[model samples]
Target: MKENGIYGLIAEFEEPDQVLAAARQARAAGYRRVEAYTPYLVEDLAEELGMHNTGVPLICLLCGITGGLGGYGMEYFAAAIHYPINVGGRPLHSWPAFIPITFELTVLFAALGTVIGMLILNGLPRPHHPVFETPFFEQRNQSHFYLCIEAKDPLFDRTITQEFLLKQKPAHVWEVLA
Candidate 1:
């Protein structure tokens, strides 16, 4: 546990199903700070770990609306308010002329917002994590799966958690240090 220098304990399994089972068990055991790592996607594993909803979609929607309004507003100000120019006898506040720029800005802002929001939401730019120190790739096949119970979990106790993980019958149980 985080009581000392321990980040948590990580259990390595040979198959995806094994890690998935361990994740479910850990969740049921009241470990809230659980995390899983696998060679590929295991969709059900995320549900078991309570990693469902994210705010990236809301961020995209808000940013898209802002970009569209901003683009249209800028065009209106430039063409009608700042310097009115009636080309071809068209009205100064021609909204049709603003559509292309508004559409482009909406898409651009949404895409950029999605990326930035995902990074911020996921705590990205993490050059290093405690799990990275573990020998996950070393001592076994390349397709191993790992389930970690972080010390931040309220139910974490070094001795008891170690015993619990042993009961899961993992291929290997490692004490991950922070």
Candidate 2:
């Protein structure tokens, strides 16, 4: 099934249910590496892939903490240590004055972290992928759903995987090439 050098085996499905069932079947069959493509969102597909716990929130939290500390420290150093100008008999180390800027910085950094983390996790800016070589690729942009079992997977075998995909009752099955 080496069509122009095989990257993997891809199956095309007509409905989200078919793709979801196909992904579940692949997972149940001990296939650890599987990918699904669809024209729109299908939440169950991601659940089947066990992609529920992304670390974006943790990244955002760390960034927010760092930003808050940095902002507060900078203000503290500037007013309390460097300048030390007491205004209206108020203490030089006034934490209340730092709260607004510290909060702002925390939100800004957290937002930035969320964006950067998402792009990094999703492998963004990727202009090309081997799946694009499949003839059914065009259909993916329209209405078709695709599930691919990568060749690099530990359980992959050309004949066996092809048979497995065929058993999923897809519209078409192809040997994806790099």
Candidate 3:
């Protein structure tokens, strides 16, 4: 059993289907802290890995709404209340004039929120990950599929997890070092 902080077991498979199957089995066996890496997106993989309920979309929506409201409010305050500028005999609170800015701000905030939300959700900007300690992890971006069960899982133990991974018939099962 590895005694490192990142003491986790990784199972390497030749095909994405095998990884998906192993993930389903892991989820069924009550493993909550499991993640799979694949070269390309796999349909139903998120559900199999129990990662379906992400909140990024909701966050993006809220941010877009906030941005649209903020832009509209700023325009209202500047043109109508604070510094009323009636140009070309137009009304101070012209809705048509504010539409373009409001739309632009909504798109800008939605895009920004999506990017930041994804980064935050995925725990990004982590230049170095404990999984990098494994030699075979580099194959993740190529042909192999990997499923890692983190030590943070309540049912995690290096020896038992390694045994379980081996039973899944992976080509290689290694312990990640922190």
**Which runs in model 1 stand beyond 4 Å of their true positions?**
137-142
Candidate 3 Cα outliers beyond 4 Å, as residue runs = 1-6
Candidate 2 lDDT by residue in tens digits, 1-178: 2234678899999999999999999999998779998899987798897677778899999999998999999999999999899799998988998999999999999899989998999998799988899895865657899999988888888889999999999999988887
User: Over the stretch 1-178, how does candidate 3's per-residue lDDT look in tens digits?
Assistant: 2255675888999998899999999998889889888888988998998877788899899999999999999999999999997699999999997999999999999999989999999999899888888775774547888899999888888778888889899999887876
lDDT of 1 by residue, 1-178 (tens): 4567889988888888888889999988889999998888887898889877778899999999989999999999999999997799999998987899999999999999999999998899898889887775454535788888998888899999989888888888899888
lDDT over C-alpha atoms for residue 177 of model 1: 89
Q: Which structure among the candidates has the greatest lDDT? A: 2
Q: Name every residue pair that clashes in candidate 3.
A: none
lDDT of all predictions, in order shown? Answer: 0.87, 0.89, 0.87
TM-score to true structure, per model = 0.91, 0.90, 0.92
**Best TM-score among the predictions, by candidate number:** 3
In model 2, where do residues sit more than 4 Å from their true spots? 1-4
Give the least accurate 10-residue stretch of model 3, judged by summed lDDT.
Answer: 1-10
lDDT, candidate 2, equals 0.89
